[model samples]
Each structure stands twice: as structure tokens, then as C-alpha cells.
Target chain A: MATTIIETGGLTRSYGDICALKPLDLQVPEGEWLSVMGHSGSGKSTLMNLVGGLDRPSAGSLMVGGEDLLALSEDGLARFRREFVGIIFQQHHLVPYLTAVENVMLAQYFHSVPDEAEARSALERVGLGHRLKNRPGELSGGEQQRVCIARAIINSPKLLLGDEPTGNLDHKSTVMIMELLKELRAEERFTVVMVTHNQEVAAWGDRTIYLDDGVLVREERTNS
Target chain B: MLFRILKNSFLKRPKAVLLIFLSITMGAAVATAFLGISGEISHKMALELRSYGANILLEPSAVEGGFLREEDLPKIKTVFWKYNITGFTPYLFSIAEFSAGGKKERGVVSGTWFAKQLEVPGEDSSIQGIKGIAPWWEVQGRWPEDAAEAIIGAALAKRLNVVAGGDVTTIVRGRSQQFRIVGVVTTGGYEEEQLFAPLVTVQSLLQLPGKVSRVLVSALTVPMDDFGKKDPATMSKDEYEKWYCTAYVTSVAKNVEEVMAGSRAKPIWQIASAEGALLKKLNSVMLLLTVLALGASATAVSTSLMASMAERSPEIALMKAVGADRFQISAIFVGETLLISMAGGVVGYLLGDQLAEVISRTVFSSTIVSPLWLFPTAIISALSVAIAGSVVPLRRALLIEPVRVLKG
Candidate 1:
């Protein structure tokens, strides 16, 4: 029996009168790759944000790593996010002024003391070793996404959240980024929660759940 | 990491940093210049007030040509309040016809000590002369050293066509004495029309032995207050004793009067009181302007920083998302501002020093030496401006919601 890393009981988030995520119960065991598939405005990103501690849910309980996230203050949530969950955005948000190495070091800095050697090795693991000094603008779409991956995992977070991490990439770059994430997960043994609309991307995960109109409609287990 | 981030950010936005730097620099510069000059002005004014020709004028108490005995001069140094007196010079005046190179002018021939050394029993010997009391008088040549030597006034020198090396014949009544003009003095007052010579030489020339018509005394004195203004004749014994002990101009004049026989001493109230009032007003004005200037620059720094913070919201948000706490974020921004302010302060101090020199030269017709304490003052004030300007902006930076900012 595996321990549940993330457990949500009737976790719901709403903006004004429009409910983004209805009261839904969800669970992910440790080291499981959980994929969320949804159309636009289908509450996939909302679930990812809440689980990553980026935003607060309108109602219900959210527990990550056996700690109640709902009870944590804003600063506490920030610490939770940095220590437990790493987020990769579709836009690959890197501080534009900082180089790839510095971006990686930023996560390590917030977690504890920044170790340049660790940050450099993390970038090397993401296949960005040669481009450590290059800023985000100097890298290609795939390279920039790789830099984001490097920064996200620099602190060795226990959970990784990717909201369309490869949405802006070409098929070749998308496959490369997916393979890289798969390799990193295999080595790090961290649970992954990814939100995507693509069936092929969802197929990379061990399990997939479909959300529609702020409700979970279907679920499937992928053969990995 | 914080310093690295701030360094990169500042480098990336040179224009914004420069804007803040310029405002802080200007504020610090103005503060330094105003404060430096104000301090120097007050010091100079005190000296000028003390040197205002003479604060006390002594004349023979008897009517007409009655003179005080010259032997009583040393008694001025042995008075009850003698230490307060800086210098005193005696003068004896007589009308004479001055003729040189066929040019003639009738002028008052004033006899005065040039740099006479006097010794009083039980006191250190001191130099008491016109050189100490009348520092404003511009003399082109040396003082007279012999009975045949004299210093002609600028006006008399011009009228008689006499130069410093030339000889002037002084005719008193039916008697005539030829004297070498050792110096031509320009006093910019009635002294410019009179001739000046050694007191002993003039006494012999006029045949009045050991007599001084008047004396001018310069003394360091406190500004007069209500008690100091009270009439000495009406004060009680204790009040009079207290008044006499204080080094007010009135009290010093009274002290000199007591020591000099058959002489009346009067304080030159016009110069003393006017100098005090003018210095007080000028210092207040400088302080007011310094405050206004600092306030204005602080506002400028605030405005510029606020604008920059708005432009850098996304950067700030990203930092927060990366798990930077409020203290970490504030440290980055405040540390940057403090560093910039320190740089501005040093630059401002150098600039303000030159500015003060220029201002003093142009306005006061003199130069000023900047005091050493002003450097720290400039830096501290610059730090204050930076901190004051960044308070609202840092609070705003802390309140920035990373979720909303990172959404776009």
C-alpha cells in the first residue's frame, strides 16, 4: 500500500458566481503521475493551482504531504510550495534578467542557502549545462522550458505540477521535454500532477482524469 | 542572491536608478551646501561682529580738548573684566597742513599706536594697537617706526601727491615737521581723509605730552539680554555685580570706563545688535531652505521609485512565487536604495563643497573651509531621504499578489 501524497475532499474554487472547480474528491498516491485533461475553462488549471498552493480554494479541505494546506497562511503556503511542489507553466516563466543558472539558484536560495554547484548540476541534468549563462530570451522554446524544469526541481521538491508545460513546443520539442520529465521523475521518484488537453501528453502519465463544466466526468489508468 | 538580483535589476534599468540617484544627489548636495555655508557664515559673522571697527569707544570725560593720561593705558589690562577685552588703541587728533611735491591739503592728523606692546603687573604682556582693533583698514605699506615716519590716508595721499616712499611736510600752527610716508591706508570712512602717525611722535609734534583724545576697544561679548539692557545706575548691588560679571558689550564698556581715568566708555550698539540680529535671521533662513530642499528631493525620489516599482511588478511577483518572503523582498529593495543613497551622498558632498566655495566667494566675498563633520551629515541625510522615499514603495512591493501578477 502506497501513502497518499495529495488528498482533496470536496475541494472547490470559484471566482465570484462562476465556479471553476466543483466540490470534487481526489487522491494521488506517492510517486504517481496524475494527468488532468480538460477543455478551456474546464477547471483543470484551477485544480493544479490549488494543489500547488498558488491560490486558495473557495471551499473544502486540501491536504498535501499529510499537512492541511487550507490552514497555512500565505507565507506558509509559499514555503509549502517551494519545499514540496514545483510548478512548470506553459509560458516557462523565468526571471528574464537572470541567466539559466541564476534562475535555478533562485529556488535553492528560497528553500535554504543557494548552492551554485547543485544548481549547475540541476541545469546539467535538464540538458542545459552548456547554456547556463544564457538568459531566457537567448534560449529556444524547448531550451527555455528545460531551464524552467531545472529551476523547478533545483530544490528537489517532493511534488511537480505542470500546467501545459509543453503547450507552446513543437512535436519534437514536446516529446523531448516529456522524455526529460519522465527521466527526471524516474530518478527523483517525485509525484507529478500535469494538466493538459492533449491525449498523447496525457498518455505519458500513469493515470488520467477528465474534467468538464467544473466536474470530473471520467477517469482512466494508462499502461506505462 | 538578493544582492545579485538587485544588481542585475539596477543594471538592466539604468535610467530608473539614475533618476533616483540624481534626485538623492541633488538633495544631499543642497543640504550640505546650505549647512556648510550657514555654519561658516555664523562663524564669520561672530568674528566680524567682534571686529566691527570697535565695539567700545572711549573719550575724555571733561569737555573740549581734555585728554586721558597715556600712562593709564596699561590699567585697561588690569580691569575687573580685563580678559574679555581683546584690544584697545588710543588716538590723539590735531589739525595740520600736509604738503608734498608742491601739493597741499589740510587734514586731521590722528596719532595712534601701530602695534604697541603693553605690560600690566600680574598679567601676561599683550600687543594692544590699531592692528588688532581695526583689521578692516587696508594699508598698502608698512607702519611708521620713527618720529620722522607717518602713514597718510588715501585721500590725503592723493591730494598731496604722496606715495609710501615720499616725504610729507606737516605744518602745525607756526611749527613744521617733515615726515617720510611709510604707508598709505584706505579706511573707506572719515579715516581716509585724516593722516595717521605714531602716538608718541604726534604728541611731540603737537607738543601735548602723554595725552590721548580717544580710545577704541574691541572685546568679545555676549549678546545683550533684558537684564544686560538694564541701566547699571538703577540695578541693585547684587544685580549690578551679576551684570558686571557677564561679558556683555555694555558690561565690558563699563569695565573699561572704570579702569581708564577721566574717560567715558560707550558700546557701539548699532554694529553689535545689528550683527546679532542679521546672523540669527540668516541662520534660520538657511535651515529653512535646507529642510525645504530635502523635502522636495525626498518627494522626487519617492515618485521616481514608485514609478519603477510599478514597472517591475512582474519581477517582484516572480520573486515571491520563487518563495521569497516579505523580509527577503524588503531586504533586496531597501539594500539597493541604501547603496545608491550612499553613492549619491559622497558625490553630493564633493559637489556641495565646490558649490559652497562658489556661493561664499560670490555672495560673501570670502572663502569657506568645509568642516569635517559635514561628510557624515551628508551621508546620513542621504540615507534618510532614501529610506523615507522607499517606505511606501516597499510596502507596495510586499503587498503584490504573485498569483495575479504571474497570471499574465
Candidate 2:
């Protein structure tokens, strides 16, 4: 009887002559973790971008948290992205000039007003208290990704989107990032839509949807 | 938060920020220097032209047996446009036989004030003479100082075979007077064909006391426009009043004529018209140069900012991807540019002041004091160039697609 937080009916996206995502009908209940699995060029990232409001669907309806994204302006979509969705890119795209704490505050700055103490606390939660003043160049790959996570979760979003959040990390660092996400999600009670190619990483989600050549192929449920 | 980001960005990317800053600074410096010196250049040029000759000529109304009163010369300093009358000198010419060094010749003998100081009621004492009005006259020796001393013209001295330290006897209708030749003057004009002596001595020798043939007046006047060229006799009451009040050469001449009885004052058009035309052209050239320099500097700033924007695309994309709206993105970039421009404005103003001084000293052999408003003008111009330069790059930055950029 859980309420559905995301509902997409025949959602589609195309770039010029090529369709990145076919008509996709999907729904995710509140607080559920949904994983999208696909091979290279299989439109997994396209779905994540559309759901995160970073890209628009060419056709069909997309409703997230009772808001019709198709009807919103570009600025409205930006507001929705800041208030409703937080995205963690696989590249760990942090502003190299800003420190770890300042990077987290950047998110709060866009959301409302920057709170330095809260940004510090968010970094501390991500286990980067000692590296608060260190810029992205001074941090390791895993540590930078942790700063990305801290920045993502600082605004308290309702839906968190991860595009292979651990694609560049080794097995140990990947496991640590997943464990941290699991703990944060348990406490925050936010929905997660993670896109990945690794079967082991997909196993961390409550359910997995596989895509092949821009079409949905199969589904799997995890008993975690 | 904006300030923090701007600080860190500038600290981290000194090369790009400095490039844009330098462009704005150069533009602002050129603008400030040109604008600062433009007004001074015209004034200096006018003063230089004034040395060519006097612009106003005063003479008796009648051509025959006509004379201007010598006592009326002091009233020239108390006219409505008195301050505009920089200097004036009176001349009394009489044909006489000049004899010096055992040689004799017939030439014109001219009496004029040679740097005599005049004090009028309710007016400060002022030096008014040929020395002030005709500065181009080159003298081989000193000017005459006493009733017995005279400065003979080069031609007249050559005709009489006389030099400085010689004595000359001038005979007018058999009334002869002796004068010590103190100086020999070369004027390249009719003055070189006449002998110059103190006015009082000439008046006494000619038995024509307190009488002058002509007066040359020099005045500072604005360039004549159509309104200034209008005849006061044909104008309405208000228009005539306006024309009379303006410091045009014609108006200033009229002011002098009204003061001197039975005298006609007219502008020496050869000098006044030439000065007006030259001043007008010089001002136009300065204005054109200022606009061209500003345009060139704007191009430099735009090119530099565009290049920096290209290099910073990834950072802008990252900001956009992190939920920075258009206003936020604009704020960051605009804030950075404004901070750089303000610093550039201050630096450019200082540099431009020095530049104006150098130009003034080199061209006019004088110094210039920039007006107080030039400071704010320079800063505003810098800001304008910065904003103008940021337009295209800011638009490009806003058009950046985060998905494409971050995917790289």
C-alpha cells in the first residue's frame, strides 16, 4: 500500500534520428530503490537524466511527486531538480576550485541559502570532517566521490539519482560507497534510482530493470 | 556564497582573470587619458592661436581727420566683457623724417604702449601693451623705457643706417625731437617699416596730445556658431540680449565699441574665423579618437573574456548541473567581472593621469589637472566595457548542456 513517488507512462526521448529511450512505463513506490541495468549505449543514463529533470522526454507523461515535469518551464525544472532530486554523476564532477565543505555548500546555495555549519556536518557524515578544507585536487578518487555524495544529499532531496556512482572506483571503494548510500537512505527515507552495468551493484537495489538497445528487456527483484 | 566562489575562482585561475582584467584596464586607460586631455588641448591650442595676432580692431568712425581718444583706452578694461579682453594697445602714426648716425630717411613714426600698467576704478591694475598683444615681435635689443628712448623698426633702422645705442632725430613739420635708439625690432609686418616710441613723447612731439589712430584688442572668445553670427540689429530683444551676453568675437567687439566713443570695433575675421575653424576641427578629432579607442578596447576585452569562457566551460557546466539557475550562474560571472573592472578602473585612472600629464607636457609644454568627474567616468566606462564584453560569453555559458559537458 505504499504510495507511488514516480510514475512514467510511455516516456520517450530521442536525439535527432536516433531514439535514446523507447516508450517506458514504470512506477516506483516511495522509499524504494530502483536499479536500471544496461550495456554500453543502451540508454540507461538517458533514463536517469530524464527522471532527474536534467533532460526532457520527447514524448509521453512523467510525473514525479505529483508534479508534471512536461508542463514546467526550464527554471521550474531547475527548481524541481534542486528541491526534489539530487544526482551523483559517475565522474564525480566537483568544482575543482571549491573546498570539500564549499562544494557541499554550493548545493545549499542553489537550493536556498548556504549554511556552512550544515555543509560541514554533511561532509562529516560522509566521513570527510578532516578533509573539509581540502580541494578536489587534494582528495583521492573515493574521497572526491564522497564529497560528491555529501553535496548531493546536502539539500535533502526526495529522490536521489546515481549514474554509476562507483564506476571508476575499485571493488573495495565501491562497496564502501554502496554501504554509505544504504545507511543514508535508511535514515533519509528517500527513493533511489541507480543506473549501473555491474550485477553486483544492481543486487543492492530493491528491484532491477534491464534495458537493451533503448528498450526494456527484463526485470529482477532482490530480497535484501 | 557568491563572494566565496568569486574569491576562490580568482585565486585559482589567475591567468584567465588577469587576461580579462588587463583588457579592461587598457580600454579604460585609453578612454581616461583621451577624455582627460581633450578639453585642455583645445584651451592650449586657442592660447597658441592667440599669439598669431589680435582678433579685434578698433579705429575712429571717420576715415579722414579721425582720431581715438587716448584716455578712453583705460575704459576698455571696464567693459561688459572686460575679463575676456586679454590685452590691448593703442597706436598713433605720423609720417616724419628720421635722422640717426649722420643718415636721414622719411618713415612712419608710431606711438604705442609697451607694457604700460593701467588702473581703473573698481578694477584691478592690468598691464596692457604691444608686448602683451603682439608676442611674436622679435627685438634685437630692449624696449624703450623713457620719453627720450625709441625702438626703431628693422627696415627703418636699416634705411637710417642706425642700430641700438644710437640716437635719432624725428622732424614733424619742422618741430624736431631727438630719441635714443634703444632697440631694433623685426615684426615681418608694416610695424617693421615704422619707428616705435613712448606714446606720451610722440603725442608731445606731434602736438596732438591724448589722441590715438587705432587700437588692437585681444580677447578670448568661443567658436562662432549660427546664432553668434546673427546681427544684433536684426534680432528680437531676448535674442539680442543673449547674443550680447555671449563671449563671441563679434559680441566682445561690440562691447568694446560701446565703451569707446566715436570708435568702430570689428573682428579681424582672418584670425577669429581661422581660430574658430581650427578649434572646432581639433575638438572633432579628439572626440573621434576617443570613440575609436573605446571601440578597440571593447574588442580586446570581448576577445579575452570569450577565450576565458571557453576554458571555464566545464566549471560552468558543473555549476549548472548542481542546480544553479540562470540567475545564479549570471551572478557568479558578473560578480567576478565587476570586481576585476573596479580594480582595473582604479589602476587605469592612475595610469591615465600620468599619461595625460606626459601628453600635455610634450605637446603644450604645460601641465594639466584632470577634472574630478573623470574618476567616476573612468570607472563607469570600465564597467560598461566589462558588461559589453561579457554578453556573448555569458550567453554561450547559459546555453551549455550539462549532460553533454559532464559526460565528457
Candidate 3:
């Protein structure tokens, strides 16, 4: 009975007349690894978008670590995103122009004054020490995702959201990224919400939730 | 950090930055050269007019009363502006005939202090009294060194078939004096149809020693308005001389009258004032050219920055999404423009100076010296163009929807 880190009640989202996410209720305890599994358009990515402050819920109360996210202004939300939450996308959205170290430094720039030395160490922690000066186009897919992971956690956010963090990786690279994430979570103790379609990936988390047609159909707990 | 960012960004896109830089440079160069040469020309023209003898002239109070005496010169030099007094050359004109190269022509025989012989204290030939007064006079030969020698004007010399080392005779009051022609002067005025000799020699030969009809005085005077040229009869005596001697045209005339006995004086201002009006118009045209040039520069900058902004939307969205406010984003873009402008301004100023020299030399066949203040003026103009042109594009950059763009 750990304290709950995220609480959502009656959360719903709509685009025009079509509902993208229906009302739902969920609670996740602190320091948990939760995996969301579903097909494309299953509302899993939409739910992640709402939780990550990228989109607003049409009707809901979202309390993340005791803060009411719905009441924050745009800039306030940006500050919250910088200081409290970090997100990784499937596309690896790292700026192509900056090197791996500089990409990590950008997260610090948003949170505070960028510290190059700290960013360098962050890249090294992600096993990108040898590719600090390599641009995204120059790095392999796995290395680019590693740099994105480095950027996400450079600010030491309390929450990490991954939308297919290794969707484009090879089988070995996928295992490498998951192991890296599991190790980082063990040390940092930040809660993670990962969206994936692979059951093997879902097994790594403490609990797995399944969604279909924007509705939660089932929930499974794997860890004792 | 902003400068570093500016430098890095500029280096990243040299082609785009160079386009804006070159355009701003052209704008600054045009502004600096036109305004610089315009100001200098106005000042130089003013100086040239100042040396055109008295702005106000004086003769005997009554035409037949009498002439001024040589003793009056000391009093003229001792006026309130005794120090501001430049120099005075006296003249006594007599209608006479002269012969040169076996040809005789009727010419005005003028008595000048030295006519053409120029020498100062340290020099061998005298530099006074007429040679110093008429500096713009182009001379073909030397001025007369002896009392019996004279210089003929180019027009009169051609009419009389005369050259240097020739002789001419002048008849006045039933007495004729033979004098050698020493020099021919061209003043581009009525002075070109006259003969010049030593004042003492002319006075004695005419049997009117120590007498001068009038005097031409060159003084440094301030510019005057139309009201400053009001008729003297309409002014009170206190108002008269005050208006006459304050280094202005009216002041010069009043000062000359105060010193010379039974004589009146006038300034050369009427001619200068007319020239001033024309010059003021020319300067306005130059100013119009500068404004139009800057406007064109701004337009060019705007076009190029807009093109760059199109290519940089993704970067702008990236920065915006990363929590950069509008001001910070603008700093990066405008800072880039300003840095390029600084380099452009320095290059443009040097280019424009040479351009002005070439244009002036080719058109007017006269050398134009570009002044120093043009450099900073060029830089400021370039900076302003860069700032002005980037404003709208920067606003466009700020308006980019970070979420929409990044999501795309």
C-alpha cells in the first residue's frame, strides 16, 4: 500500500463530435511500472497524450502527484512538463542538428539554465558517451532512442511517459532499451507509463492495461 | 550566449545570412555616401562664396561728392571686428586704350595693389594685394612686379591681341602711361575684360594720388536669410550698421561704410543666397534618394528573412515547444540579423565612399573627398534595416503553434 502517484476520474476527450477517449477511472501507486497495450486507435496513445499534458481532456479530473493538472495555464503546464514530467515518442523527435549531448542539454535548457557537463554525464549514463557529438542522422536507431531517453530523464523528472520507446528498434535493441529503462527506474524510482502492443514488453511492467475502441476492456497484474 | 547563438546560426546558414547582409550593406552605403558628400559640398560652396568680395558694397555717399583716400584703409581695418577682417583690395578704374601685338583695343584700366605680382614676407614675389583677394582667378602668366607693369584680363587680352611680356599704353585725363603686360587673369566675370596695374602707379599717372573710388573686402561672414537682406533706407541707423557689420552681408557693408569716407559698400550675398536656395533643393533630392534607398533595403531584407523563416519553421516550433517564450525566440532571430548587418555596414561604408568619389569625378570632373562620420552612419542604417525588416517575420515565428508543428 504505496501512496497513489496518479489519479484520474471520468476522463474523456473529443475531437469535434467524435469521442477519442471515453470516461475512465484509474489509480496507479507510486514507483510502479504500468504498461498500456492496445492496437492502433485503441485510445492508448490518446490517453498518453492527455496524461502528458499534450492535449486537454474534455471532462475529467487528473491528479498527478497531488497537483491538479487541469487547472494549470499553458505556461504553467509547460513548467510542469519541464520540472515534473518527461515524455519519449516513437519517432525519437531529437533535433537532427544538435549532437547527442546537446540534445540532452535541451531538456535542461527548458527546466533551467542548461549545464553542458551534466548533460554529458546524462548521455554517458545512457551508454552514449562515445557518440556525444554525433547527430541523430549519424547515429543508429537504437543510439538515437538512447539519446532521446537521455534527454527525457536529464531533468530527473518525477514521471516518465514512453510512447513506443523502442517501437522501431531491432529485437536485441528492444531488449537493451527495456533493460536500460528497468535499471534506470530501479535507481531513480520514478513511475513509468509505457504504451506498447507487445505482450512480452507488457510483462516487464508491474501491471498491464488493455484498451479497445477508446474503452478500457481489461486489466492484468503480473508482479506479486 | 545570444551572440554565440547568433554566430552559430549565421554560420549554419551562410547563404541566407549573406543575402540579407549584402542588401543591408547596399542601403547603408548609399545613405552614407550621399549624405556625406552633400554636407561637404554645402560647406565647401559656402566657403567659396565667402571669398567672393564684400556682400554689401559702398560708394561715395553722393556719386559726385568724391572718392575714398588711402588713409581710410587703416580706419576700415580698425572696425569692431578688426581681427575678423580678412583683407581689402582697393581699385580705381579709368577707361583707357591699350596696344599689344600691333593691335589696339579699348579696355578698362584698373589700379590694383599688385595686380598679379604675388609675394608674402618670406616669399620673393608679392602675394598681395589683388592676387590674395582673387584666389579663384586662373592666371596664364605672372603678375606685374614693377610699377610700370600690368596684367590684362584674358578676355581683354584676346581682344587687344596681347600676351605676357607685351606692352600697352593707357590714356587718362589727357595723360598716357606705357606699361608692360605681365599676366592675363580669368575671373569668369566682368573682371576678365579689364587691365590691372599697381595702385600707386595708376593714381600718380592719373594725377589723383592716394585716391580710390571703392574697395573690395573679403571677410568671413555668417549666412543670412531674406529678411537680413532688407533695404537699408527702410532701417534705422542703429539697426542699419548692426545689420551691416556682424560678419553677415549687411554687416560687412555697414562696416565698410563706417570706415571709408563718403563711400558705401555691398556684399556678394545676393548671388550666394540664390545659389544657396538651389543647393538646398539639391540636398533635399539627395535626402530623398537616401530614404528611397533604405526603403528598398528594408524590402529586400524582409523578402529574404521571410524566405529563411519558411525554411526555419520546424526549428522555431522546436524552440517554442522547448519552453522558449516569444522574446527569447525573437532574440535568436533578430540577433542573427544584427550580427550580419554589422559586418555589412563596415563593408558598405568603404564601398560607398569609393562609389561617391567615382560618381562625382565622372559627373562633375572634380574630386570629392569623403568624410569620416559616414562609417558609423552606414552601420547604424544597416542595423536599423535589419531590425526593421525582420520584425514581421519574427512575429510570424512567434505565432507558430508548437504542439501542432511538433505533432506534425
- For model 2, residues B1-408, the per-residue Cα lDDT tens digits are 989999999999998889888888887888889889988988888778889889999999985369999988999999999888889999998999988778889999988999998989999999989999999999999998898899999999998889999999999998988999999999999888898998999998899899999999999888899999998999999999999999899999999999999899999999999999998998899888877776777787788778888888888887877788899889999899999999988888888888999999999899999999999988987998889888888899899888888872
Better of 2 and 3 by lDDT: 2
Candidate 3 per-residue C-alpha lDDT over B322-374 given as tens digits, one digit per residue, 9 for 90 to 100: 55556667777888888889998888888888888876677556777766677
lDDT of 3 at B115: 44
**A1-224: candidate 1 lDDT, tens digit per residue:** 99999999999999999999999999999999999999999999889889988889999999999889999987888788878888888888888888999988888888899888988999999898899999999999999999999988887889999989999999999999999999999999999999999999999999999999889999999996
Q: TM-score of each candidate?
A: 0.72, 0.87, 0.69
- Which stretch of 10 consecutive residues in model 2 chain B shows the poorest summed lDDT? B290-299
Q: Candidate 3 regions off by >4 Å?
A: A1-78, A191-224, B1-11, B27-39, B43-267, B285-295, B349-375
Interface RMSD of each: 1.5, 1.1, 2.7
The fraction of reference A/B contacts recovered in model 2 reads: 0.62
For candidate 1, what is the DockQ-based docking class? acceptable
* Candidate rank order under TM-score: 2, 1, 3
The 10 consecutive residues of candidate 3 chain B with the worst lDDT sum are B118-127
Give each model's whole-structure lDDT: 0.89, 0.90, 0.78
The TM-score between candidate 1 and the true structure equals 0.72
Among all candidates shown, the one with the greatest lDDT: 2
TM-score for candidate 2, residues paired by index:
0.87
Stretch of 10 with least lDDT, candidate 3 chain A? A73-82
Model 1: native contacts recovered, as a fraction: 0.46
Give a tens-digit lDDT track for model 2, residues A100-173.
99999999999999999999999999999999999999999999999999999999989999999999999999
